[model samples]
Target: MEKARAEAGWLMPKTSGYAACAKLRRRGDYKEGTMDFFDECEIKQSIQRIDELLGSGIFDRKHIGNVLYRSAFIDLLICLRDLMFKCRKFSEPIRFTDDVVVTDEIKHVSDLVKYVRDAVCHPDSDAHYLEPGNIRASLNVLYGKGTLIQTGDFNSVSEHDDDVCFFIGRQRIYLQRHIVRAFNEAKDKLLPLVEAASQKAIAESIAGIIR
Candidate 1:
């Protein structure tokens, strides 16, 4: 119940990247024909999908064993992976941004995103289709810490007493928190940087034409 409480605490209202960018576009905050414009738009679409899946009541404790829940969880993981792993188009821009400091927190969150992406993509190598000793060892490494059911061959997100864990299919990863944080990183940090760069490029192009 404590973990549940913790999970519930972070569900405050969040602005959608899609809506924010749409409003900005309507206001002509930046030019329309920039790569950053489309990149941010696409990234926001992924983030919005992630938010919808997480907040759609699919991960309720009652739905833990449901097939639909499993499918939705897989979808959530894929969305997260695609955002950070596949769609890191803004990383280089952020790296060169003079005003934005890429802090350790950002680094850690990115690392966790990559870890889950790898885990989801290569679960067989990590947990299944390996020798018994190897399998148990890998499971222990993944979801065993601070959990009662650390060394089994289960494949769902399970909670026993206070500990929540994933054996194969899902994750002990606090799915909501990780997904939200990643979404914020993209929406808050990377999106702005990209948008600024796009505006600058657009201004330079316009000035060159005027000159």
Candidate 2:
């Protein structure tokens, strides 16, 4: 139910893009009788949707991944993909403004996000879905090592003592910590960069249409 509520922003344009843009135009929120006005408006609207989807999630997790802590984990990946993915409106490579060095940690986190995103969106099989894999991933991120579960033994996140990850009490804590770290890094360092770039994309798109 909470996830459904959070997805409301992403669903908005699909629900009301045409009518809302028309309404905006009538109100002079966009320049009247302009060539790029509507296109630019749409680009800004897309960026706004991305912003709304980035609303707060659990970042204060004292330990690692939990039932409730998954919001930030999932949302951050979606947000990163939006920023880095190619878009005609923004021709430049998405990057940091202050030039914060992309260290191994950042790169690893990025890779993990993509990996997790793929698993979520396109799993090969039900057995290969987000179960033991998620547990293993959390262990890898937090403990520097992870053990894989035998499918015959454990397959679900709820699967307990039979899981390879079941015995790792230390990892349960680490998993949440890793999640909190990833969420914080994206929020503190990456959010502003993407936001500035998104604004620039909207402005440039508008400029192109008008010129």
lDDT of candidate 2? 0.38
TM-score of each: 0.50, 0.34
lDDT of each: 0.49, 0.38
| TM-score, cand. 2 vs. native | 0.34
lDDT of 2 by residue, 30-146 (tens): 443332334434444444544554344333324346564455445545554443432312333333222111245234433444444444444352323325545323322222344
Model 1 Cα RMSD, 1 decimal: 13.7
**Model 2: how far residue 38 lies from native, Å:** 9.1
For model 2, which pairs clash?
63-176, 63-177, 64-175, 64-176, 64-177, 65-175, 65-176
Q: lDDT (0-100) at residue 186 of candidate 2?
A: 40
Report the number of the highest-lDDT candidate. Answer: 1
- Number of clashing pairs, model 1? 0
lDDT of 1 by residue, 1-211 (tens): 3223122221112444345445555776555444444464456677778888867876666767677765676677676666664335545321221211124433454555555555656655443323353443223222223443433563433333333344432233454344555566656655566557555555654555566
